[model samples]
Structure formats: structure tokens, C-alpha cells
Target: MSIPHEIENYIKLQPESKRNDMLELHERILQNLPSCKLWFLDGKNEQGKLVSNPNIGYGSYLMKYADGTTKEFYRIGISANTTGISVYIMGIDDKNHLPQMYGKRIGKATVTGYCIKFKALKDINRDVLEQAIKDGAKPRF
Candidate 1:
């Protein structure tokens, strides 16, 4: 249940070719969010069925839902997909902000409303990615 254990397990479960990239991204995120909180989601549903890729999260924020409910969640997240990796930037009010700001500069990554996904770290710009993570961690609402 420890954050390091969970992160190690998740990375070990990834394909051989993806492990190093995952590790580098992990370190990069940690460097960008020094002293921030860490989170690991095993991608399991209540029944323990796999629903998503394991996620390593950083920072903290209160997520408010439409029904006026709120819960604490990470501000940024990193995960490995079947094809590659995904960096999630949560809590932004404008859905278009990420794509507009990072889309053109991030190289091969796909910049969506809240996610920047790419086949590998070398396929994208590390500086841009770090900036996105830093921006995502700030409260924008």
C-alpha cells in the first residue's frame, strides 16, 4: 500500500521497452513537484477488476462534482497505456487550455482537455511536459 511499492509494482508490470521511460517520467514528475504528495491507484474497481492502467499521482486538490459533492484527488497523474504513456492535468477550468497551450510544442504527444499522451518520452518535449504539470498543479478555478 505504500506509494513507492505501488509505483514499483506498476512499472514492473509494464512492457520491458516501457520500463525505463516510465522511470524517467516518474523521476521528472517528482523533480517538478518536489515535496508534493504522492498517490498510486492500482486501476482496480471495488471488486478488484482491472478498469484502467495503474496511475501515479502528484499534488492534491478538492474535486467538486456537479451534484455539489467534493473529494480529494491528485492534481496531476501519470500512467502507462497499452501503446504508451499518459500525463493527466486535472482541475483546469478551461477544457481547451491544455491543448491550446501545449499542443503545438509538445512534439508527438496528443494534448487533450486534461491529458497529454505520447508513445514515448523521446517523442515529446520534456520542458513542455513539466510546464504542463506545474500549471496543472495550481488551483485554476
Candidate 2:
């Protein structure tokens, strides 16, 4: 699907009350990560176009690094009850690297395998998140 279509569809799914909040969050993300290529992912997996799981409900921006690699920058997503915003980094399977790089900034963030989930956007350090995104895009074996 086209970018605009994806954006519209994703927005349509949100309650009218949260539309403005979502847009503000979306714009903030774009402003923060200028080099990333954005894509709206079905975190909840209810779209039926891809996977269908309810544990995830969020939008993501897929950024491709200069090294020809890419990573996911999740803006905001809902999981049945809670809301989250996250950015994935290198060694998704390596816990040591994440904490070493992010430290306490990863508030309530739990990493399972390669997925990193933050409690909210405000809790994270944007600079660290940006570096993590760049690190995620770095060549990995």
C-alpha cells in the first residue's frame, strides 16, 4: 500500500478522540528521525493483511541505514490494554548491549529476542533511541 493510504488507514483505526494525539506523536517522531523511511505496521495484527495477533497494536517507521540495513522505529502501539512506543536496536537477542547503551532510559522496556517495548515516548532518551536505530541499521551477522 502507498504511504498516504497506510497513514490514512492507520489513523482511521484510532478513535476520533485520539486522532490529534496520534498525529502529534507521528510528527514528533518524523521530526526526531529524519533519515528513516516510515511505514505503518499493524502491531495488533488485526488488519488481517499480515499476521493476526492481538499482543501488538502500534505504528512503526522502518528506517534503512546508509549501510543498506534497516530497523523499526515504533511510534505508538496498543496491546490489548496498555500503550507503548519503542525503537529496536542491534543484537535484538543480546540484552547486554541494549542496557549498556540505554541504561535507565529504557524505562519499563522489556526486550524479548529483538523487540524492545518502551512504556511511553517520554520515558525514553531520544538521542539514545536515535543511536539505537542507527545501531540497528548497522550490518549484523
Candidate 3:
């Protein structure tokens, strides 16, 4: 399958050591959620200044704010960080869900409420990570 130009560029821009990891993770995510929506964020502010690492997002959900406003956003996001990579699991109401569910099983990764940070794919258990991603993608409160 052809990836969007923006997402392609995002992967291309990563360091050599990280490019393959990004691509593999991207493909793994697709395999887990075939035909899911794809999203790319350039990590720029309105003025075009870089603010965060570029993100490759998957799936969709309507995010409600306290002020009653809502916006559509991705349910899962993958991004390259200075040290390694991060997988963001959005929309989980219980902040402890991730750590409690997958912390010990996820290998060397750091499991936070909505983010899984790791140095490399080899450092983490892919099967466990996949499970977390799948569970995180589901709608829950």
C-alpha cells in the first residue's frame, strides 16, 4: 500500500538508525488495524516553527473538551524522539491503565499513561506492545 507523501517524508527525515524502526512500527500498526485512517502532523506551530516531533497517527475519535468543544483526533500516534521513539495511546480515562496493564510485560519500554517510550524495537516486546495498541484504540472511558 502507498503511504501518504507527508507520512513518507516524516519517516525519511528521521536519523538512519531510526528510519527502519519507524517503518517497521508503521507497518506493524497497519497490520493491526488494516485500512484505518492515517494522519501526519508536521510538528509545527501556526508560525511554522517546529514544536514537537512529527507524528504518524492512526484511527480517529472525537475529543471532548471541558468547555464543551470537540475535535477529531487520532487514537494512536507514533513519533521519533531524540533518544528513540514514542507511541501515544490517547483517550484512556484511567491514567494508570497503561502501566497497570502492560508495564512489566512490555519489556524495556517506559510505560506512561498514554505514551510508551523505548530506545529500540528490540528493547521491547512487540507482542505486548501490539496488545497495548489494540486495547488503546478501542473506545473506553
Candidate 4:
């Protein structure tokens, strides 16, 4: 797949030392996410070309329902700065019932429209996170 020119340029501009690390990180995210159609959006750049900030506006991974009869939902991206990775999941509504079902794994979650912002990945369980991504998505139709 061809990455957007901006993303390609951005990656090309990264320091050679950090390039491999970022590539692996990006690949890990893609691997962890369920197989689906991948799309890229131009992330905002307020603080220059550094990838450390939440510069990549919103990155979405689209997944289809099991029956393939429903709409495809988005797993929004959140940059985990301290951890040097991004976390993907469904938004606020998904996080609502998560605490009871996920307990301490959820830690704390903040809502923003249909999306939720959280701090650490360790705070949420992987199974819970994946389920949230699946449940958080809305029908495309």
C-alpha cells in the first residue's frame, strides 16, 4: 500500500537511528490489530516533524464485522508518548461498561466524542482492548 506523501515524507525525514524503532512500532500496531482495510489520514503538525507528539491527527484502522453484513467500524488511534507506541480502540461509549468488565485494567479513560483517550496500555487488558475496538465501531451503512 502506498503511504500518503506526507507520511512518506515524514518517515523519510526521521533520524536514521530512530527510523527502525518507529517502523517496528508501527508494524506492531498493524499486527496487533485484526486484519482489515487500513487507511491513513494526515496528522497535524504543530510542533514540527517530531513523531513524539500527537502529531498524527487521527489514525484509523477499519474492521468488518464477522457476519460481513454490518458496517465497518473504526479503531481510533491514541499516541502513548511515554510508552513510545499508539493505542487503538473504540471511543467513550465502549469504555463506559469497560470498567465493570475489565476492572483495574481500564485504569482511567476520558471521552472525546465517539472516542476515548487513555494513558497507559498496561492499564487495559489486551482482550478488553480488542473487544472495545470491535464493539466501539459503528455500522458504515
Best by lDDT, which number? Answer: 3
RMSD of 3: 2.0
Q: Is candidate 3 or candidate 4 better by TM-score?
A: 3
lDDT of 3 at 58: 97
Candidate 3 shows a clash count of 0
Model 1 residue 17 distance off true place after TM-score fit, in angstroms: 2.7
Task: Report model 1's TM-score to 2 decimal places.
Answer: 0.95
Rank by lDDT, descending? 3, 1, 2, 4
In order, the Cα lDDT scores of the candidates are: 0.90, 0.51, 0.92, 0.46
lDDT by residue for model 2 (1-141), tens:
876476766655665544444455556555555555555555444455645322222334455688999886543332321454333443344667766766566556665434566655556565665555555544454
Q: Candidates 1 and 3: which is better by lDDT?
A: 3
Worst 10 residues of 1 by lDDT: 132-141
Model 3 pairs in collision: none
TM-score ranking, high to low: 1, 3, 2, 4
lDDT tens digits by residue: candidate 4, 4-111: 454455445556534444454355445554454454544445665554443232234344566875543345553434433344444344445544544445445543
lDDT digits (tens) for residues 39-134 of candidate 1: 999889999999988899999989999999999999999999978999999899899999999999999989999999999988999999888888
Writing each residue's lDDT as its tens digit, candidate 3 over 13-111 gives: 888879999999999999989978999888899999999988899999888899999999999999999899999999998899999999999999999
Clash pairs for candidate 2: 43-56, 43-57, 44-56, 44-57, 57-77, 57-78, 58-77, 92-113
Against the true structure, candidate 2 reaches a TM-score of: 0.49
